[model samples]
Target chain A: SAVISQKPSRDICQRGTSLTIQCQVDSQVTMMFWYRQQPGQSLTLIATANQGSEATYESGFVIDKFPISRPNLTFSTLTVSNMSPEDSSIYLCSVGGSRYEQYFGPGTRLTVT
Target chain B: GQQVMQIPQYQHVQEGEDFTTYCNSSTTLSNIQWYKQRPGGHPVFLIQLVKSGEVKKQKRLTFQFGEAKKNSSLHITATQTTDVGTYFCAGEDTGGFKTIFGAGTRLFVKA
Candidate 1:
């Protein structure tokens, strides 16, 4: 398993504003992903943050709304653009550690008012 | 996309009693991993099952993978108060590192 640290454990933002969350892994990893979990709901994949390239957005998710950046193997960022009340949720970052093992960060709780 | 379905959305059990949660997938999986998330905390890895009909134990908890590799279960014997939280099952498909997480079963252990 890998140790991941996410910044701004939580934040309160106004609607129409933007917030950027950062994820840093203790060690180098091959793949890093971003996921969203609404209150009392299951986790949903937002995008795959790839190093030195554009992120891969999942179906029903767009890059314009959630821009992701992976500058290196151990760091990545996800920016929620034009926040809305519906966008208020827990944002999580996960990294593929070893054979089929995924490790997650503590998560960032975002509240859009 | 693969889907992992978890059953008994919520479970309430008395301490020292037993509890179980089941996970079924639409497609066969190469491996399935279990995670436990305490209230207000992130999901933590518990164990991973790789072979068909495989059973692994961690103290009072037992995990099993179906013979078809499309289902799995987690059984806790003598449940404790510390067991209160959500249990999730994540599956890793063959030849893919992408993991699909189940909705999870919330467990409530009462004294």
Candidate 2:
């Protein structure tokens, strides 16, 4: 299994500002993804981070809002540009492991005032 | 896009009781996985089912994949306070590697 880590466990930002969350994996992985979870809600896939390529975002999400960068198999980043109160959520990074099991990072909780 | 639905969004059980959560997918899933997330914690993989009509057990936990590959279930026997968490089921679609997560079932174990 893979061990994933995220930076800035929790942060408070002002509206219109931005926050970049980092994800690191202990081992190389072919699939890396970003997700968001609102309070008392389920996880929502944000985008897929592909090494050396642009991220594939899910519907209702755009690069201008959440730009992703994957320099290699072991690291990735997601930036919440122009933050707003609605953008406040817990951002999680995940990597596919052996079989269908996937490991997730500790998650970065962002609160935009 | 594929979607997964989980039943009984919220469940409360006394310690030592049993609890179960069901997940249904709109399309045939190539693989199904279960994850557990404690309060204020990230999701951690619990198990995965790839074969149809498969059943696997881990201590007090039991996981099942339906014959149609469109549904799955997670059962926890003799639930404890430590078992209080949210359970999510994710499905891998046929063509792409896109993984979709279910709404999740929140379990509360009252000691």
Could you say which candidate leads in lDDT? 2
Docking class of 1: medium
- Candidate 1 regions exceeding 4 Å error are none
The residue-by-residue lDDT of candidate 1 on B11-49, one tens digit each, is: 999999999999999999999999898899988888899
Candidate 1 per-residue lDDT over residues A1-113, each given as its tens digit: 79999998999999999999999999999899999988777778898899999998888999899999999999999999999999999999999766666788999999999
Clashing pairs in 2: none
Q: What lDDT score goes with residue B12 in model 2?
A: 94
**Residue range with the least summed lDDT across 10 consecutive positions in model 2 chain B:** B92-101
Every candidate's TM-score, chain A alone? 0.98, 0.97
The global Cα lDDT (0 to 1) of model 2 is 0.94
Please give the TM-score that candidate 1 achieves against the real structure: 0.97
Task: Give the fraction of true interface contacts kept by model 2.
Answer: 0.86
Residue A72 lDDT, candidate 1, scale 0-100 = 96
